[model samples]
Every structure is written in C-alpha cells, then in structure tokens.
Target: MNTLYRLGQFSIALTFPALAILLAVFGLPAVLLFLSSLNAPDFSLTNYEAFFSRGANVRVLLQTVEVSVIATLMCVIVGYPTAYIFAAASKGLRMALLVLVVIPYLTSFLVRTYAWIVILGDGGLINTLLLELGLISSPIPLIYNRMAVYIGMVHIMLPIMVLPLVSVMVGIDKSLSAAARSMGARPFAAFCRVFFPLSLPGVLSGSLLVFVLCLGFYITPAALGGLGDAMLSTFIAAQVESSFDLARIAASSFVLLGLAAVVLGIFGLDLSGAQDSRPHPAWKSPPDWLRSFGAPTRRVKELAARHRAKRWASTLYQAAGRGHLWKVVGTAFVALVMFYLLFPSVVVIIMSFSAGPSLHFPPRALSLQWYRSFFNNPSWTDAAWISIQIGLAVAVLSTIVGTLAAYGLSRTFPRLRSTLTMTILTPITIPSIVVGIAAYLGLLKVGLIGTKTGIILTHSIGATAYVVVIVSATLANFDRRLELAAKSMRASPLRAFTRVTLPLVRPGIIAGALFAFLHSFDEVVQTSLVSGFSVRTLPLKMWENIRHEIDPTIAAVASMLVLLPVAWLIVFYFTLWRSRPTVSGVPLETAS
Candidate 1:
C-alpha cells in the first residue's frame, strides 16, 4: 500500500517542474504588460485613461465588434450548406474535400492574404476580367473596403466553420429526420426541427473561434481594407509601429483581450440541449378543440408541403442516389467554397512561375526567373536562414516544455483540469498584437530586445500553447496499462514512462514540434514588434517589400513557403511510418 501511494505520488510530482516554468514564461510578461501600461514617468493610470478617453479608440472598438459579428454570421451562412453536404457525402468525396480545406489551412497566413491583393488590386484579375467583358470603364475599386475585408476573412474562416459543423452533423441520427418525415413533416421542416438545432453547439464553437481570430486579424485587413477600414489590431499595431507608446499600446492590448474573452465564452456555451437528461415533454395527437380556427389556411399549406415531402422521401428511400434540389445546390456551393479556400494558394503558385516583373491575372509567359531571383538575392536568403534557425529553436523549446505541461495536466485532479487548460492557453486566448506589445515591453526591460535568443524565447511562449493543447489531447487516449506492466517488472516509474509510454505518443510530440516550428517560422505580429533592423525574418522582410509594392520575388517566396509545410508534413509521417514495426518484424507496407 505504501509503495502504491508513492507510485501515485511520483506521477503527480512529475508535473511540478514543468508547471513552474510555464508559469514563469507566461505569467512574467503578463505582469510586465500591466506594469508597462502603468508607466507614465512614474506609476500611474494615465495611459489607460488616454486609451479609453479617445473617441476614435471607442469607435474602433465598436467597429471591431461589429465587423466580427458580421463576419461570424457570414461564415455560418456560407458554411452551413457546405457542411451539410460534406456530412452526408461518401467516404472518398469527404476525404478529398477535407484535404482541399487543410491545404490552404496549413499554408502561410501572409501568403494567402497577399494573394487576395494580387487578385483584387488595381489592374488585377477581377478588373482585367471586367475589362475583357466590357462590364465597366475601369477598375471597380474592389480591394480596399469592407467588402474586400469580408471576402478575405470569410474565405479564410469558412473551413473553420465547416470542420466543426460536419463533425457534429455526422453524428446525428438520420432516423430522427426520417421518422419526422414519415409522421407528415416536410423535408425542410424536419431538417429545421431536427438537425439544425442539434448542430448549434458546433455552430457556436466554430463561430466563436472565427470571431476571436478575426479580432486579432492584422494582415488580411491591413492588406485588403486599406487605412479607412482599420481593425482594432491595426490601431494596436500602430501604437507599436508608428507611435512607440508602450503604455497606451499595453492598455489597448488589454481592451482587445477583453473582447476576445467574450468570444471564447461562446466556446463554453451550452446551446446543444444535450445535457437535459430528463425525457422531452410528452407529445399527443392534436385535437380539433386545440387547433385555432383562424390558422386553418396555414395548416392546409403545411399539410400540402408534408404530402410532397413524404412522396420525395419515398423516392429517396427507394432510390439511394436521388437528392432534393436543395441538396444539389448545397453540394455545388460546397465545391465553390472549396475552390475559394484553395484559390489564393493556387494563384500564388501560378504567379511564382511568371517571367514578368509585375503581377498580372494570367501571365503572358512563364519561367523560373523569379525563383532564381529569390535564391540569388542575399538579403532574402539570409533573412530566410535566420527564420529557419528561429523556427527550429522555438520548436524544440516549446515542444519540451509543452510535453511536460501536458503530462502535468493529465496527472492533475479532474476538478482542476479545466482551470489548468485555460491557464495554459491564455497566451493564445489573448490577441497576438497584445502579446507582441507585452513581449516587446517585457524583453526590452531585460535588455534582450533585437537578440536572437530573446526572439526565440518570445516565440516559444505562443508556440508552447499549441503544443500543450495537442499533446494533452493525445495523452487523453493513451493507455496506462502498458506503463504499469513495465513498472510491475521492477522498472522505475521514470524508466517505465520513457520505455513504454513515449513511443506511442511520439507522433503527438513530433506534431507539436512541427506546429511550433511553422508558427515561429511564420510568426509576424510579435516578431514585427520586437525585431530591429539587424533581425529581419523572412516574414518581416516580405512585409517591408509588401508595403513598397515589390512583387514577383515575393510571389516566388510565397510559393515556396506554401509548399514547404506540406513537404514537411509528408516527410515527418513517412519517417514515422517506416519506424513502426509490424506483426512479423516487417514494416507496415510489407507486412501484408
């Protein structure tokens, strides 16, 4: 019994060191940001007061909320039908569409956002098409407005909505809708009454994710919305980039953090009604006395619709391939949405092969000249090398810390798990612009600003959040018996864990590392704030060129960036697959 107690204590004790480091890394900057906001030659609330007192600040905050709400609604409207079709799709088709969605999702954020500029800018694809068809005298001013912001944001957010919605919809019992139809309900009515409400949890979750991400949007709006349509992040960034007012910047960061918290609340919302364990209120046949005489005409119409649905349902039941008009439309719309999701990446790749010095819709000719330019340019290549180093460093540090934190959380008491989870994700929960300001202020106080070591440490704070989430989830499914078996054979707990547990969860660790690397490699908001002239990363370098309207070379760089992650993803899994043993000491491929 004493040994068993120590064994349990040993598992719990392992979490302490990781938890302490996580606390120091995330907590210190947070405290610093608050103190920085109080800096006004002495400790004071002047910055907070100034941040709130300005009318423009309030208006921008309001505008940010308004745009976020509209964007969330638009994502739902565009994503619902597509999700429905995907949920009902055959296995092959569903897998294919999922890959299409993930390709752009895994691509560079700036690269995709930048492609929209080329497609919508002056004398760009849309305008060229308009000119060719003689629809307008000149460009229609498509690039720098709320319309463009919505288009770019919605295209990016659509997949976020579809993924969650499809997961929920696929689990819904089709029998519920079929039973409703057989009981004289119309197709649309049955769908509305049965499936849509049940899918609300997913809708709410996805909408909230999109809304919070929209709050922190820096690139898409900046590139596409122009100056007049700036987001909250734009103002926050302006404080860092233009004004250098660290106090007000930190204050503004807190304000944006508040709004993001409100959106995260939507994730915790319980709209699915699945928790009501009690049986639903009893139903009985309707009687003439309960029916209102004045509603007779409405009842007649409803009955007619039901009759039509019953006939259609019969047809669908008898012939498996038959589908309704709405289904057909929904499927086609999903295809178009998939194309939209992939379109920007496609445009970047195509333009990478262009021979010209400027961006055009369909290039008159193609060559590898721009690619060669990226290779030959010392400035671009050196910056990329720096980014690669930073990414690797961040990936390693974040993965180690994150894996430990995940282990700690898994061994912690269940009652405390939710609080721990939220605490670990706090860095991600806050807007990046806020984090950037906080990191910049915190690092400067320690004389680490512009240093590679400082930048790598700063990047790891955010990267660790991703690793913790991924590794914790993977650990949730892990079997403890294998480790127990090793322990029963007289192995120490640490040895048991290393020998038995780590191999099974290695994939998750590697995945966490990969994500951390990509995030650090592509990191912009924080890097932009902290980096000096000597510390230009590839993203920062491209950002400078983007503002100056330097094309072609950026297109080539974007194309390579787009494919690099995909290649890494394939190679990582290939190596892992080869390392796994089969039933008779063969690899998986040859075992059969």
Candidate 2:
C-alpha cells in the first residue's frame, strides 16, 4: 500500500527502470565509444585521420552516400504517384491497399533480402525463365551486381516512403484542389500548385527515414551486391570480423553515425507526420487586389456563363472521357507496384515446398521435405527455440518498462518528454551496427556477452523504444477522467490503474508486445555483434545458412518467416485497426 502510494506520488520514477537499462546498455556505451574513437585520456584525432587516409575507406564512404541518395530518389520517384492514387482511393480500397503495403514492410528484413536472392540468382526465377524462352544464353549476372543492389534496396524501402506520403495525402483537403480547379486551374496544375507543396513534409519524412536507414545498409548490400558494392556498414562489419581493433571500429561506427546525423540535420528530421495532421484553416481571405478585382468580374462571368456553357460542357465531356483512361492507367500502375512488392514472397513460399535439394521456382515435384528438414534438424530447432525464449523475454520486459516510460512521459512537460523520448529512441534511430557495437562494449563490461541475457538486453533497448512510441500514441488519446473517477470511488491508485487505465490502454500494450517480439525475432545485425559468435537465434541461423550454403531448407525457413508478418497483420487488424481510436499504434506504419 505504501509502495503504491509512493509510486503514484512521483510518476516520473516509473521511467527509471527503462532509462537505467538504456543508459547501461546503449547510452553509456555510445559515449564510451565516442571516447574510444578519440583515444580518451590521450584524446587524439589519429584514429579518424587513419580512417580517411585509406583510399578504400574513403571510396566506401563516398559510395555509401551515393547509393543511399540514388535509392532514396528511386523510392520518391515510384512512391509519390502511388501515394497520390492511394490517398484518392475510397476508404475500403485504401484500407486494403494499406495492408498490402504493410505486409512487406512488417516482414522480416532478412527474409525479404533472401527472397530477392532467390529471384535474382543465376539459377533463380528470371534467368531460368529467360533460358526457357530462348531469349538468353546465360544468366546475365543478375544477382551480384549494382543493379540487383538497387532493386533489393528499393523494394525494401518503398513502403517506408509510401506510407508517410499516403498518411499526409489522405489528410489533405480534397476541396483545396477543387478550389484550385474552380479558379480555372487544370487538374495537373491544381495538383502541382496546391497538393504537391503540402505533401512535401511527408516526402521529407519518408526520404529522411529511407536515406538514413540506407546509409547503414548491411544485410541487403552484403547479401545481394558484389564486392565493390560495399556500404560503410559492410566495411564496419568486415573490420569487426577481421580484427577487434577498438579505436578503428569506434572511429568507423561514429563516422557512420555522424553521416546519419548530418543528413537528419540537413533535411530536418520529423519522423512523426504531425505537421500534416494539423487542421487547415476553413478559409483564407483572398488578397486585397484579388478581392478588389473579383466582385465585378464574378457578376460579369455569371452573366456570360450561359454563353460559354457549350464550350465548357464540351470540355467537361472530353475531360470525363480522359478521366477513365487516366483511372485505368493509375490502377495498372498501382497493380504493378503491388506485384513488385509481393511477388518475391510468393515466389519464395512456392519454392519452399520443392522436393529438390536446391532452389527451383517451379519445382518438378512438390513435397514437405524442406519443412521436415527444418523441424527434424536439431541445429535449426534449437536456434528457433532459443529465439522464442529470448523474444518472449524481450517482449515482456520492453512492454512493462516502455509502457511505464510512456505513461511517465505523458505526465511530463512537453520539452522534458520530447528530450526523454528522443533519448529512449536512440538505440533504434541510429544505425543498427552502431547500436550493436555499443551493446557489445556495454555487455562486455558487465560480462553478459555471448549469453541469452546479452541478446535479450540488446534486443530490449530498441524494442522498448517501439513500445514507448505505440503506448504514447495510445495515451495521447486516453481519457484521464476514468482513472480519476475510479480513484474517487475509494479505489487505491494501483487499483484504479490496473482496473481502469490498464484496460483502456490494453490494446496499445498488446500491439507493443507484438512489435517488441517481432523486433527481437527479426534482429540479426545487432544480435550478431552482441552474440560473440556463441549464441544463435533463428535469424542468426538463417543468415548463416544464406551466406554459407545453398539449401532449399532455407526456403522453408524463409516461407515461415514470411508468414510471421501476415500473422502479425491479422493480429494488428483485430487489435489496433478494429479498436479505431489507437489505430496509429500499428508498428512502423508511420515513420513515427
């Protein structure tokens, strides 16, 4: 009773456990890493100088920037029109299209990357089809090239760009464009002058999200690209494998971090599309000159309107005729975009059941041999089991800690909440390899490395940030009076919270737990660094198999991985979607 009372008195204390874990695991280590890069106590620029002095290092840095810029541009080019169509869609159609976009976004990053490998490999789908059609003599080097790198990257990043754009575009006033049209602007002119400017924030948000994420490109570039296609993250990972040179590694990690920070600073980061949702003024007064000239002209135009009706009616008819054609073109374009996003997964799922020892898109025979191989094999089963245990632990821990932190932040001043929320999000907002290196050093200090405890802790920091975001969004809409009413009825603070507040916020909590589990389950970049090569989670195991051997068993594994997102989507629909009020709690659905 006393403890509950004391806890209720200081709501901010609720954030401590999460903050403590973050500080120990990520924050402190990041500071230490910065110091390590500077050779702290001695404090020299030698390490950084050494890094830039190398021609290969400099080239990789430049290449990372180039690739990220090109990929971001590609996403913008493809995503803008798709988003426009999506926003203009009817409610039911928009909802369905959103689900389609999210399925790939929520799918395992590793699985998606692997699907591209299966499709683009010499023996994979495209090449094989070409050979059968007698269109090509050889595979044409599809898999391991710069072009494949762009294809895989753009596929993975398209949803990130589209989702934000659609969110902003949907909230825009359709009447604004109609108003422009009434002012005698053509449809394209109206869109360019009114709609496009308003959607820039979404574009900025999506582009920042994609570009920063791409700056840290690791798994896809390494898996799909040739040796010359290495990003900074690839270089950093290779250095870690080759040597445990702390200063050099820290220098490289900070350099990558600095690159991300510079981009964020340059473009101005706003992961939350809050600006787009702000209510527009119902009407803005016309300019003095326009108002002065408009009254006489309006009456004159009204009198002349019947005279121009024949020409106007003819224009309307022709416009309506072209509208159907544009509609068909838009529908076809959207269909192609959906195909590009989803076809790879469909390919992998079909190939998973192959009776053959190696990958084949259209297998001569279909069997459950690969599935049986995955289950019966001890190595695969053990890794899966280990991953489950760790995921459960991370989910539970992150949910509790993050929910409390979010609740605390909700009670805080705006500036303090913003600062603390950003602090909590540090693990996830920066590159994974940077976070991984920090986690490794932190865990090393505490002797938790190479254990499930270390991996759980490593996964928890980022997972907790996800939880905070979801729960905070839910709390933003929560009615505080319910808890107060419960307390007024003589219920204790804990009782009021557990009985009233918790139930109201339960949906967000559940969604957060799901996201936390998924975050941990799909993690490989940080897991690999912190595992010290001793622990093997499912993703780690799958990554190993993908890199080392060419086995159809991996197809079975990848197929199962693909289903996880589909399952998550179904669960999300029931929880966040149906719940209505907290629909934004959908994981990564927003850049927020």
Candidate 3:
C-alpha cells in the first residue's frame, strides 16, 4: 500500500507536465492539422484532389526531391573524405578540423545562402575575379539557378553530414586495414574490402538527415533558385502569401509529410540492420612462417618492414606535425565560408549606410540613411518589433516545453517511447510552409489567424521538435542518479529537479533556447501565414524588401544577426569550459 502510494506520487509528478507539453506542442497541433485539412462546408477529399490537379505543386514537389537528393549526395561525397581525414588525423588536428566544420553550422542559414548570391551574381566577386583573370568575357549565369540552390544547400547541410559520419568513423577499428594487409591485401584493396563497408551506416544516416532537412528548406532556394527552380517549401509559401489557398497548401503539406516519412522509414530500417551487423575485428600476431625466415631473409624482411613502417609513419606524422599549419588553413577555410555566408548580409548592411536613395554595394559614401529610413517606416519597424517579440516568446516557451519532453522521453519505457519520439520529431519532417498553411486554416475558426499570438504559437510549435532533439541529446549523456540521490535525501521532485538536474543540463537547455530563438527569428513561411498586417516579423520585412529593392540594408541586418549568434556561441563555449574540471572527472555509467 505504501509502495503503491509512492508510485502514485511519482506518476502524478511526471505525467501532468509531460502530458501538458505533449498535448500543447505536439498532440494538439497535429490534431489541429488534421481538422484543418478536413474542415470545409462539407467533408471531402477535394483538398487532396486539388493538390494533385495543380501541375505547379507537382513540379515543386519533384524539384524539392531532386534538390534534396543532389544536395545530400554532394554532402556525403564531400563529408566522407573530410570525416575520414579527421578520424585518421591526430587529436589536435581533429579538433581543429571539427571547429572549422562547426563555424558554418553556428552561423545563420539565411546569411550563408545570401553569401552564395554575392559570389554567384553578376558583377559579384566570383564573376569579377574571373573576368579580371580573362577566364570569361561575360559573367556566368550562376545565381538564380538550380546549381546555385544545390551549392548553397550543400554548404549549410554539409556539417550535419560530416558530424554523424565522424561519430561512426571514430568507432571504427584503426587496425582493420593492418589486419587486412597482413593477409596480403594491398592498402587500397584493404580499404575497399573492409573499411568502406563498415562506414556505410554513417553514410546512409547522414544522407537521410541531409535529405530530410533539405526537403523543408525555403531560404536557400528562395534566395538562390530561379522561378522555375522552386522547391516545395518555396511553392507552399507562395500559395499562402500570394494565392491564400488554405486547402491546397494543406494537401501539399500532407504529400511532403508522407514522402519524408517513407524516406526516413526506409533509412531507419537500414540503420537498425547496420547497427546490428557491426563486426568486431580482432588483432592477430604475424604469421610464424614470416617470423621464421633465415637470418639473411629475416634481416631483409625486417629492413623492408621497417622501411615501409617508417614511410607510412612519416606520411602520417608529417600530416599531424603540420597541425598548427592546418589550424591556420582550416581557420582560413572557415573564414572564407563565413565571408561567403555573410557577404550578402554584409552588402545589405553596407547599403543600409548608403548616402543615396537607391541600394548600392560599396556605398558611395557612408550614411545611416537606410537605417533612419527603416526606423521611420512604420510597417518595417512594426514587423521587426513583432518578430522580435514573437521570437523571444517562442524561444522561451519551446525551450521549456521541449526540455520537459526530452526529460520524459529520455526515460526508459516500452515501444511507446519510440512512438513518442517520432511524434516529437514529426514537426521537423513536416514542411514549414505546410505547418503555416495548416495553422492558418485551422486557426481561422479559433480566431488565431492575423494575430501575434497565433504567429508566436506557430513558431513555437515548429521550434519545439528541434529543441527536443538537442535537449534530449544532452539528457542522454546526463547522470540520472544525481536526481535519485536528491530524492533519497527527502527533496521533493520539483526541488530535486530545480537544485540538481537543471544546473547540470543548463548548457544544453541554453543551446536549445538559442537555436529556438534563431529559428523563430529567421522563420518566414509560417510567420507569413499567421501574421496579419498588424503583426510583421523581421524576416517577413526582409522578404518584402528583397522582393522590391534588392538593397544592401538587408545585408547589414544579416551581418548583425550573424555576429549576435557567434558572440553568444563564444560566451556559451567559455561558460562550458569554465564549468568543467581541469582534470578529467569520473565517468558516468553507460547503458548496457
């Protein structure tokens, strides 16, 4: 009876908060999506039918898949070599390489996509340099094309591919190649026969991740692709913002969601098999025959082996010894990517300071004319303010709800755990434009459309899944026994959570919050649908400006955005470093 009472108390403590978060952020929003798709004067499949009937929608869906597949393929091709190099390199070199990869990820995706515009556009750096070098008399048609979209998307998504590949690669036995060589296999042949097959899981997993992410991409394609190069996300946005057809948008979203699920399911199955099939390589001694040669033959063999080992070791040592040089080179590479990512935004910033009425890069002279103009314009300022407010609200709410969901789902449970995980991650799989349209249609009856609250709620919903994933990762590595100990000391669950669990996981929670804030701050499609004339966000304002002016002030805004997050990351890293012991602490228990 006493044990039952304790169990009841635990259930009460855990269930309500988890349920509240799940229903509000995950369950309710999904239910609303279904209702919105079905709600009409009469129940019908007309939305789905209209979706198929529209040739443009079909084209957009196909284009989205094409871009995603191409980008993911490019990521794998590029990322595999990069990850292999990192895994084989010495520790210092690996860390430096990792830092280089992470820089692009830390920066804004919009900014990076914008940077490609500056590089690929007519009269831009790439064209100007090529022309100066007499490579071509005319600028190439690079920007506003399918190729540009692929390049931009790949640049932003490459780190995602590389990180996962690196994780898997680190687990590979370094002596597998040596073992194969001892069996008389050549170096290249050994790699082909052994190493490549072992790394297939990482390749598939990374490719799937990049592809799914690319499916929902809007900023890169919208900024880089031509009219005919539109992807599903861009098309859906156009539907909501221009056509305002809620039903068609919902149907298109459903198609995107269904396709993403199929792709992910296939990849998930493959990953499961791959995980189970991993072979543990065992080391073996050199053959006795080889060890028992005549003194002269043994001496020759010894000399040859030493020579070969020295040659291989020298090659690797030389590469590793140049770690400092590689750091500099990696830093330069990262800086170049950053410059490319930030160039358009930097141009916009420069233009914002233009003395003239029109937008210009390398402003004739510097003035805060656009800045004054922007502030003076009520529409732009109002939108900017609304976006800031919505972003902050969404960031806080999503972080809190997502952290709780992460905690609940991270606990041991039945098969329902995987189902719940899928539910939490579903928002990311669904196209944002679809989410936007669904929210618009569903909320119309609830009077959420054309309201600031509606926009905040929508952004929060979209940001929650990302937060959950990030926070869940942090929780996965956390020590739960600390909480148990606190509970044993007579601390209530809330107190134990507040005093123990919160501090330990604060870094991840903050990281999740920062990501959520940036996501909401940069969101365009969903915000466009829910936001009325009265509630305009910064990205919406930027979208409007890009459509009309093609000015440098946008660049300026983007540069500022890039700097703020980079600055936050710096502080975050410092805080993380300071919190850790200089000496290695005791390791936590791992799952069996």
Candidate 4:
C-alpha cells in the first residue's frame, strides 16, 4: 500500500503504460524502419535515389500533394459559409445542425467511400436517372475519375473541417460584429473585418487537419480513382503487395511523412501549448501582420453619409427585406450541404434492402435478402465476431491507459505535457499508410504478425490517442479544488478520485470508451498491414469484397455500420443526462 501510494504521487508514472505500448508498437519500429531505409551503420541514400529515379513514383508523389490541396480548398470554400451560418444560428438550431455534421463525421470511412460507389458507378443513381429521362444515349464517365476522388474525399473531410471551424466561430463574440456595424460598417464589411479575422484560427486549424489527413488517404482513392489518378498511398500499397521491399517502402513512407511535416511546420500549430493569442499590430510585416478594419469602417462611414438623406423608415424596411432574403438563401445553402453530406448513407441503407441482384437506388422492391445473406455466411459472421471481441479489448485497454495518461498529463508541468501529448497523437495525425508500414515492421520482429493479438495492439495505439484527447479536454475544465477538499477530509488520493473526480468526468470516460471501440472497429489500413491474412476483421472483409467483387451482401454490412453512429449518440445522451453538471467549456471534437 505504501509503495502504491508513493508511485501514485509521481504523476508521470501513470503515463508509463501508454508510453510503453506506444514505444514497443510504433516508436522503436519507426526508428528501425528509418535505419533500414538508409542501410544503417553504412548509411546511404540509395533507396531514396532509387525511389526518385522512377518517373512514375515522382508523378504519384506530386499527384498526392495536388489532390490533397484541391480537396482541402474545396472543403474550406464549402465549409466556411456553412460554419458562419452555423455560428449565427440560435442555440437549438445550432445543436441540430452540429448533429447533422457530426453523424457523417463519425460514420465509418470505408462505408462512406462505398456510399459514393453506389451513387456514381456506371449503373448508379445519376446514370440511371439520366437514362430514364432519355437525356443521354449512354452513361457518362462519372466513377473511376479524378473528379469522383475529390467528391468522395471532400464528402468525408467536410465535417472534420466544419467542426473545428464551428467550435472556434461559436466562441467568437457576436457583439464584436455588432459593434462594427454600430460604427457605420455594413454587415458584409463588418463580417470581413471583425468576425472573419477572429475566426482565422479555425480556418488554419481546420485546413491543416483536413490537409494532413488527406495526405495519407488510401481507401478512397483506391475505390474511386482510375489508374491515372493514383495517390502516393495507393502507390505504397502496391509496393507492399508486390515487392515487400523494406527499404523502398520505408523511403516512400518517409517521403509522404516529410511532406506532411513540411506543411505542418509551415502552418506551425503550437502543439506544446495554446497559440500565442496576443493581438498583433496591423502594420506589422508578413507572417505577424494582422488585417485592419480601419479602411472598411471608413468606407462604410462615407456610404452611410451619402445615404443619410434617404427616408429613415424606407431604408429600415429595405434592410429588413434584405435580411429576409439572406435568411432564405442561408437556409437553402445549409439544406444543400446537409444533403451532400447525408444522401450517400441514405442510398446505402435503402440499397441494402434491394431485392435485385445488383445495387439499385429506390430499389424496385424491398426485401430481407441481403441481410439474410450476411447472417447465413459463416465468413462474414466470424469476421464480425472477431471485430467485436477486438473492439471490446481495445476499448478496455485504451480507456484505462488513456484515462491514466490524461490524468497524469493534467498534473504534470505544461511543457512536458504538451511535448508528450504531441508524441502520443502522431499515430493518428500522420498518414495511415505510414503508420501501417511501421506497425508491419514492428509486429514482424515480435512474430505477432498474422495474429489477432497483433491487430488488437495496432488498433489500441490509435484508439488510446483518441481517449487521451477526449479525457484531457474534460480534465482541463475540472476543478482541482474538489479533489484537494476530499484529500483534506482524510481520504486517500485514489479514494478521492474514485468518489469525487470520477463521477464528474464519468461522461467523458464513457465517451472515450465508445470512441475507442469505434476507432478499433472501423480501423482498416493498419489492420491490413499487420493481419498477414491470418485474421480477418470486418473492415478487412468488407474491403476485400469491395476490391474483388461487387457484392450486394456487403451493403448489408455497411448499413449496419451506418447505424453505429446513431447508437453512439443515444448512448452519449443517456450518459450525459444521468451525469448532469458534467464538464463543459471545451468542445469534444475540437480537442480531437
């Protein structure tokens, strides 16, 4: 008991479990992979040279950056106005709108990508509608193109872009814009000057998040793109399957990693602490320069003076009508964005019930055929059961270790906490394919490859990161005085936590556990690398079916995955309701 108490006093000790697992599974292997890439002890850039010498490899590398940038830009264009509208909305409306955005964000990635295939294929919804209308003689080339790749990627990433933007935008004081307007600034000018500048942090963070995730894309490109549109992830996947060459794979992985790091450095997210929030001088030079509202306000004052002679009542009525028109336009825009985000999932759910042999939207007849096929097939059932078991194990392991780490980090020095936190999050932030390659090398050395244990460990690394971030956000708002009060009453540290701190943060713990499960269940890229074909999780099975055959039965599996998010929301609602007065202040997804 004395030993246990002494160890608990050292907050950093609580992070050991998470750090140990991360090092064994990822950090050490990554170092080895880098060494192998350089032919260590007698290092050379031969592998890198060989990689660049291939013209096809060079093209693919450039193409990956191109696609990621374009997709990120598209997300910003669509997401900015939508998020502005979300911020301006009433509380009830904002929550409803946020739910709409988050549902798609939480949906399975592969399922979302597959939803596009059902909609854009040669015989898909659009083509079928066109043929029925007799607008065209034959199907247009919609699927398997660069355009489809962007459409699918933007669909998947839009919520990620919007959530952070909304979190930041919602926190901006509306009165700042009102103050600008009261100073004779027009609504548009006030927004451009006051609100938009205040929201720049969101834009930087959202775009950075979307761009980095896009860099490591593997499944979406593979599913939606043609041979000419291959990204680096697809290229790396090809190498893994064909050559199994360690140095080449490592070199390619590092190149992709380097691209992501360079972008991250350019944007410069201060992961060690909060961004420096002190306002900068408007006249400051590039990089530190801030936009000035002075010019826009001065111009608006001139316009107001010119219009001062106009009848005040007439001008007021005109402005009211214009406000009504803007509301209508904003409503339509939000509805359209919601449709783009959700229609694919609806199509998949409807198609799952199709009685026909192939996928069809508005299925000619609804039946239980696909669902029946899913259950009757032993392979599918076994794979699902394996995934469930692994998800549960991962959730249990990740929640305990991640919660402890979050608690420990909370008590540690700020600089040390930030540095350790960044290290922990690397698994999720970097390219999935790179993480997979490193995991493959790690498991191979331990002979855990092709085992269920290998897949669980790999999944746990990423899952634990999610748990830590969520719980840390909850902890940030937690009042330490409560715990100190309990300690003053003669309670042990562990007893005080289990009784006082634990109940208050129970909602976050529940959320972290569920996210951990979802992370493990939906995982595919890393799982594919470590599974070695001996253990098949549900995602692996679904991916194989998507690549090898167009199976309607897979739609049944996907439809089930779509419902998982709804279940999560229900669970969260109940958990939060029971634990009223829970932690607030931090937005959950924003921390993620």
Per-model TM-score, in order, reads 0.86, 0.90, 0.78, 0.93
Better of 2 and 3 by TM-score: 2
Task: Give the winner by TM-score.
Answer: 4
Q: Write down the worst ten-residue block by lDDT for model 4.
A: 583-592
lDDT of 3 at 127: 86
Q: Give the TM-score of candidate 3.
A: 0.78
lDDT of 2 by residue, 1-592 (tens): 9897898688788889899999999989999999999999899999999999999999999999999999999999999999999999999999999999988988888889999988888888999999999999988799888989999999999999999899889978899898887756668878778888788878888999899889888999999999999999999999999988999999999999999998887876743212334544434889998789787688787777665555555575354667789999999999999999999999999998787667687878999999999999999999999999999999999999999999888887776777788778878778899999999999999999999999999999999999998899888877787667778889888877777677667888998999999999999999999998899889999998889865568889989988998898788778766654322232223212
- Across 1-592, the per-residue lDDT of candidate 1 in tens digits comes to 5674475575555445445644554467767777778893599888878977999998898888888889989999988888888888897898777767767777778887788888888777788888999999878899999989998888777787888888778887889888887776667888877777777767877887788888888888888896778889998877766887767777888789877876676456322222232323234557887666658699788887878867876765574453676677777787788778888888888877876677655777888888889899999999999999999999998898888777777777765665666666766766778777777766777787898977897788888878887788668777777667678898876666666667667777888999899989988888887776569999998887777776569999999998977786686666455567232233333211
Q: After best superposition, candidate 2 residue 536: deviation in angstroms? A: 1.1
**Candidate that beats the other on lDDT, 1 or 3, i.e. the better one:** 1
Across residues 134-199, which tens digit of lDDT does each residue of candidate 3 receive? 999999898888888888888888888888888888888879877986655556778777888888
Looking at model 1, the pairs that clash are none
Total backbone collisions, model 1: 0
lDDT agreement with native, every candidate: 0.77, 0.88, 0.70, 0.88
Weakest 10 consecutive residues of candidate 2 by summed lDDT: 583-592
Candidate 1: 10-residue stretch with minimal lDDT: 583-592
> Which residues of candidate 4, in runs, are more than 4 Å off?
270-273, 279-319, 581-592
Candidate 2: misplaced stretches above 4 Å?
272-319, 577-592
Model 3 has an lDDT value of 0.70
Clashes of each: 0, 0, 8, 0
